[model samples]
Target: MYSIFGVAWFSDPRKLFALVRQRLNLGGVFVFSQPPGSLGAYGLQGMYKGGFAGPAMYTYRFSYTHAMWRSLLLSAGLRRSRDLLHEAPKPDHIGTSDCPSRVPE
Candidate 1:
């Protein structure tokens, strides 16, 4: 029994799957939710779209389609039992939006 909520950024399903495979007790279910697309990926694409060069420090890396994400999880040996994807409107962003600044915290 685990619950993950409102992760700060996109989750690599492969990593999550690995953790689940190794740590989940028998009969346990891992519940996690991520935004439609990773914020980091979107930010990088936005920068490149606006003619800004991408740096080597981009943290979030992911494809723009569901198939790509699914492939990543499947390759990691996770079977997709169920899922829900939607094209909802974007919410007003808050806090530090300088996602690609490459500055250490």
Candidate 2:
């Protein structure tokens, strides 16, 4: 499955990663992109206020270091197949991971 600029919206990344791992078929991959922690607070509050003419809303947008991403993926029974963070367009970091054939116990 591919998630572009969407993973950060997950408040609970561990649960999200586990769900993705469980749904993948053998040889499947999970690819996603989001702003890295280095980029600092990137969230929807500005958009909500500007577009909807509403007060700033509370939302979850999680960012992590490269090492943190690796650990999270491993715990969810996935392995980092490739890291396209360097090649990602400005301000976004892309990560690619391969799912194991079976979920870890």
Candidate 3:
């Protein structure tokens, strides 16, 4: 499974991750790209409802620190294979997590 600029929009990450865990085949991987927490907030109050340089709409975006991501993934029974932040070209670029479907007891 792969997500690009989408995970942040999830209203309930636990449910989203539970689904991901259920659907992932053994040895499968889940990769996602999101803005790092260091970049700060995106939407107003973590959400926005109105015109956004275009038509009127509602948007939700959540940011988390690397440590927080680790905790969340583990809680969802996903193991981090690697953190791709160091490989990113720019400092403010997206952070990527490569998680495998193996959970420890």
- lDDT agreement with native, every candidate: 0.41, 0.61, 0.63
Candidate with top lDDT is 3
In candidate 3, stretches whose alpha carbon ends up further than 4 angstroms from where it belongs are: 8-11, 38-45, 49-51, 86-105
lDDT of 1 by residue, 11-91 (tens): 555565566556655434544444455544532232123234575343443333455545544564445455554334556
- What is candidate 3's TM-score against the reference? 0.68
Could you arrange the candidates by lDDT from highest to lowest? 3, 2, 1
- The TM-score measured for candidate 2 stands at 0.66
Best by TM-score: 3
Using Cα atoms with residue i matched to residue i, what is each candidate's TM-score against the true structure? 0.43, 0.66, 0.68
> Which stretches of candidate 2 lie above 4 Å from their native place?
39-53, 87-105
Higher-ranked by lDDT: 1 or 3: 3
Q: Higher TM-score: candidate 2 or 3?
A: 3
Instruction: Sort every candidate by TM-score, greatest first.
Output: 3, 2, 1
